[model samples]
Target: MVRTIILALGLMLSVAAQAQEAKRADVEALLEASNMDAMIESIYAQTNKMFAGMGQQLGIKPDEQQLFDDYMNEVTSAMRKEVSWAKMKEPMVQIYLKHYSDKEIKDMLAFYQSETGQSMVKKMPAVTQDSMMLSQQMLQNFLPKIQVIAEDFNQKLQAHRQAK
Candidate 1:
């Protein structure tokens, strides 16, 4: 009886492990089909562009442009290394595993392998870029109002601290 129980338990564990591995593979396939690596590259490019704009706005001297560019290049390189798809794939897989079930992942994989899904994947970078620009513009328009509110909050906090 004891040997039978042990054998059964081992079989169950093996089956569970196989299921997990299969799920992980499906999730990986989904990510690949979705072009997540390209998405990460797009994000890196956008970040580099944003940093370049900030450098220009900061009025780096013409002579210092090279220094600023070098610094920005280093920063972006570090970011790319840290956020590369190779580095991120496992964590991203874990996140998907946590949030999505095996069936859901399989469904997504099927969709991503389809023509419509491929089209969405191809256009995602542009859609993301436009959305980011719209959000940034909205934030810029709202920032002065936020600053005023923050200033008022600071004054109130100072008064409260003084009273205390």
Candidate 2:
């Protein structure tokens, strides 16, 4: 009975591993459709912001849109097929399998394939763009305050050294 049980478990595990391996690429492709492009675009947008600020600060005007587009084009040129199998799937699958059953992954995939899920995928780039802009704006807003604090600390250190 013990041997039989072990054999049965082994077979089940093998089947599951195969299923995960097969569906992984499909999921990766779906994730890639939005994820990869969004990541590249984000890089472009940040670069655009940096150059725009530099142009303003240095009195050298950079064509913001053109600079952004040019950087995006360069990123696209380097884009290739999936980098690796692991890139397609989060490493948490091993834990997911341990915690959640096969049914959960399938259900999640099914939901993701649904209209709402499709819409989320479609809007993700815009969502990422807006979020990135907000985050960068926040960082830029904080910069002056950070600089002030750093300068205050530096002045105090300089005074202390002079007194010593």
Give the top-scoring candidate (TM-score): 1
lDDT of 2 by residue, 36-127 (tens): 44555555565556655554566544556567557555654444234333443475344455565556666766766788877887777678
Q: Report the lDDT tens digits of candidate 1 across residue range 1-164.
A: 99999999999999999999999999999999999999999999889779989877899999999999999999988988888889999999999999999989999999999999999999999999999999999999999999999999999999999999
* Clash pairs (backbone) in predicted model 1: none
Clashing pairs in 2: none
Taken over the whole model, the C-alpha lDDT of each candidate is 0.95, 0.65
> Candidate 2, overall lDDT?
0.65
